[model samples]
Target: MTTLAGKTVVVTGVSKGIGAAVAAAMVAAGARVIGHYGRDRAGAETAVAGAADGQATLISADFHDMAAVDAFWDDCRAAAGGRIDTLVNNAGIMRQTGGIPDPIEDWDAVWSETMTVNVHAPARLLRHAVRDWLDAGKGGSIIGIGSWAATRGTSNPRAIAYAASKAAITAATKTVARNYADRGILAYVIAPGVVRTQMSVDSAEAVGGEAAVTAGLPMGEWVPPEDIGALCAFLAEGRARHLTGSTIDLNGAAYIR
Candidate 1:
């Protein structure tokens, strides 16, 4: 079992889905988690419950707003008493629009919203964390939640913007690892194919249906959110520092390189 004892971790979008699971997993691993939730306070509370040593705190911030992202980072650091050991950039969006056939107005709106929520917001927080880590001379870890769609183009053309945003972040994460490895900074990407989340369910409906999507997977089942959470916790431990800069696929061999 991985233990994050005495570590302070920050997880964005902790209200539900992958973010919630990551937060819960880290807490159970004995890390003090500072979770960010957009609107669902109750859900965030539930996710952090039963934390090892009961040291979990929740903050609220709308990812679409750049200024709010900065505030969230500052507040998270304050809650962690000016030290954050790990940051899990797990908040994102996949709009059902932005396809080639979409109306111009709809396409533009979907692309804008998806980029803001999925890329800009998380990147902003990462920037802040990296700067703080450098200033303190205490290197940290970053675990970005990317998707297999980032490398393997999505079959649903409507998700073009979503895939693009994920690719951008994945590149940024690898760049960080490359530049900061000597300084003790670690970064990794968890690229899941079809996670069992409401987002995946919606995407499945857009392509065909959940049954069809599942049948096409080699494992014949969607990846569980808990599995991703476990991976996040292990990465957060930063035990295998040599694994930094790697994008670990959690898609059950659906899109292997």
Candidate 2:
């Protein structure tokens, strides 16, 4: 219902999972999408092929690398054919390892990669893309994909670094919103609970059966990627202008705040 016709949206991590679903949803809404992938060119090309006419373009960049991150913005700018109207910071890393006798290298890798993709890269991209738009007195929307771990303490011991990284994202969202609100650039965070992605399924299996884990949810099921995609679509539209600086939870009653 929220039409994004003529608008250009850049979604990172679009090779698969929620990123791919969000890109598809945006294309369905009539928005021209720039699907950003690190090394999954084949997957990104296939995704674009499945989209509507002139709906999606595949862009490649490694968020963990600063040089690649800069070049990515340039590529996105060029692909958008002008300014980027919507920026979806969806690329993130989740490692399930750590706690007592935790390996220092594992912690470093998780923390570093998480901060780079989930925090630093998004922050930098926003600074580059939104600054001129804001300066020129044009408004835009920025959505950061956060995790429910940012709120509740995870029982899964291996998720400490990931959780911490997401919390930082939520904080960055608020800061960006405050700093850019007057310029009409809004920022928001979508923190989803355990979704039925392959990663979640694997984690669930490691602890127990997927059904058993999902039964704990008040909704009695894991949140689907499409559901999150819908919310992201809404936030990317100008209709949610008043909802800036907020972190909306999509946990389906699991870890309700």
Candidate 3:
């Protein structure tokens, strides 16, 4: 049997990148996935179409808006037959700003948006999910998509807000795991290093050469988004409950801690 057979999963930011990959992987593993998107409705639909026949449902929500997040969950719960077994909070934005001097407006925009999507929305979603689990007397898994920047401070000042937001997510994951352990819910964070996403490629080009930046990695290659998705799938399947409350690093020896 598939590892996630009959499971119901909710994955945010499913329009593209890591979120899309995780949603697709879960559906392939026999889970019924609710693929959440913000504006990329076409991309979300493509992801669902690529899934194993009838394996996924698509929902749209502007995660930055609390009301939209609530409605997203409502639709997800209904699609999942009233039970959400796994949640993958993977929506995020990365603004690359060199250490060069910048106006306060730039800093404010990045910080505000990053915190809203990376920290606030996920926390609120977790709170609601925990309540639902308690009400239903069932357990579930929550996987937060974090970044290596959480541990390794960004060299660029423009990325400060992004790093801080992800760091907050890491701490939040631990808190949720600790408080909900006895209640039967598991929370874990996955911090990916330099993944070879479109964004990464663009950043590499903008910063000079991709090889020059990736040469620092022990693996000498950019990590794939699917790698993170696979790890998340394992966590959501409860295969390693003992590993709950942990931060699994996927940075290819970039940040060993």
Model-by-model lDDT, in order?
Answer: 0.92, 0.81, 0.83
Q: For residue 140, give model 3's deviation from the true position in Å.
A: 0.4
Q: Compare candidates 1 and 2 on lDDT and give the better one.
A: 1
**Model 1 ranges with Cα > 4 A deviation:** 52-54
Give the per-residue lDDT of model 1 (tens digit) for 75-109: 98889999999999999988888799999999999
| Candidate 2 residue 149 C-alpha distance from true site, Å | 0.4
Residue 208, model 1, lDDT = 86
lDDT tens readout by residue for model 2, 168-192 = 8789778989988988889999988
Against the true structure, candidate 2 has what lDDT?
0.81
Best by TM-score: 1
TM for every model, in the order presented, reads 0.98, 0.93, 0.94
Query: What is the RMSD of candidate 2?
Result: 1.7
| Candidates arranged by TM-score, highest first | 1, 3, 2
Give residue 2's error in model 3 in angstroms: 5.4
lDDT of 2 at 13: 88
Clashes of 3: 0
